[model samples]
Target: MPQPLIRRAGSADADVLTAVGAETFVETFGHLYPETDLRRYLAEAYALDRTRADLADPAKASWIVEADGEVIGYALAGPCALPHPEVTPDCGELKRIYLRRAWQGGGLGARLFGETMAWLQARGPRTVWLGVWSENHGAQRFYARHGFEKAGEYDFHVGDTVDREYILTRPPVSFSTVTTKTALDEHNLA
Candidate 1:
């Protein structure tokens, strides 16, 4: 397997990131969101121009996980206010965590996640949070495995029908908890 390159995204990487966001989301969430809305959301959220603007923002930090010089996944982290007192006045959120289908296995997801979390934690964020669609059980489990717990809150939308999401978090101080727990779990199983 070729080594996966992990680095902060540059302006040139925006379009690819945006495109991947749409493609991966659709592939992962097609069952929940209709094809039409999924396409619409992908286009709107990952449009080249919109993504460029986001990448250029001083307040945001984005990353691309590359393999053989091609982007296979990306992660976006930025300040956000949700999941109770926002954890900190400067708390950040894991706004996006995506990987192409081909890279979903092979340990790329865990590496990308670890890199993103390290970047955010280095910023001294009090809490890092993200929202996953209510139906994306796979994603929820992935987040949970990394110490993100549901915040017991749901975001609602009033579109053609109601849309809901669960807020999840990994506090900066809780890293040791996760590390110790994982070690214990592994020891028990062994």
Candidate 2:
């Protein structure tokens, strides 16, 4: 396959993002919820208007990965909104990162993550945060490899279902401490 094109997302890409977001979410976790609950969550979370507004927000950034003219993955980052008390306006959060199941485990996710983190730290170093499903051990391991540590726990709602989620944080590091190459090397994606 040719290399997938990864680019910054804009308000114009709302429809595609909505479709990809819902598809990826369902692909990854649909089995964990009932049909009605999953539908409710997708309706609210991937609503086109909500996505468009988010894309238009200057404080947030999103990227989409496309191959053969189809969006296969996406990542979103914005000002910290995790429930941790230590979270401040200056902190950044990895709000969402998803890839179609077939596209995972091929270093694409790491590339997408690297891009998101670079954007988050572009304004200077601040604590970075993300919430991951506690049961998703692979994801937890991936974050840990990238320097994130479990900082707390929280409930993440998907319709009426509540998932035990781990709040992970990467403390501010000087540029010299964690270069882009270092991040990729840690993942063996370089």
Candidate 3:
């Protein structure tokens, strides 16, 4: 396994980042998100140009992980919409944390997640949150292991399927002050 370097992503890396995002999404959720709707969602959410814009946006923070000098994973965090009818104050969200299929299970996911959480922490957001489809048991388990607990429920449209997602959060997680040096015994890369 090659060493994966995690760094702050810039506009120049948008194209590869976008591609990584699409591939990761397809590999991770293709079965959960219908095939027809998958392409549409990927196109809309991860188009190269849109990713470039996002990297430039002050409201969003993104990072990329490279192995063998190739971008294989990326994570994005930013302000997210809360679905609760009862309003709450500001909270940071982990919009996406994706890794190419070949990169999964390598402890790279933990590295990316720790970095993203640290990034959000520096932004002064009180809580770090994200949503995972209820059916994505793997992701749910991952989030749980990282201290994210189910906070609420919401519905979304994926292709033609209406699905439920659990809103999860790590309360008052401060990225600037958090240091996650806890490393797992690496078994295999992906």
Which candidate comes out best when scored by lDDT?
Answer: 2
Tens-digit lDDT string for candidate 1 (18-125): 877777776766567665666666666678888898789877789888888777788887777565655676677888888888777566666666666666666453
Give the total clashing residue pairs for model 1. 0
lDDT of 1 at 70: 78
- lDDT for position 59 in model 2: 98
**TM-scores, one per candidate:** 0.80, 0.94, 0.86
Predictions in order: lDDT = 0.72, 0.90, 0.78
lDDT winner, 1 or 3: 3
Error of 3 at 148 (Å): 1.3
* Decreasing TM-score order of the candidates: 2, 3, 1
lDDT of 2 by residue, 40-159 (tens): 999999999899989999999989999999899999999999999999989999999999999888788887887888888887888999999999999998889889999999999998
Which TM-score value belongs to model 1? 0.80
RMSD of each: 3.8, 1.6, 2.9
- Expressed as tens digits, the lDDT of each residue in 58-169 for candidate 3 is 8898999988888888999887675854325577789988888887886888778878777777857477779888888999988887678998999876656678888988
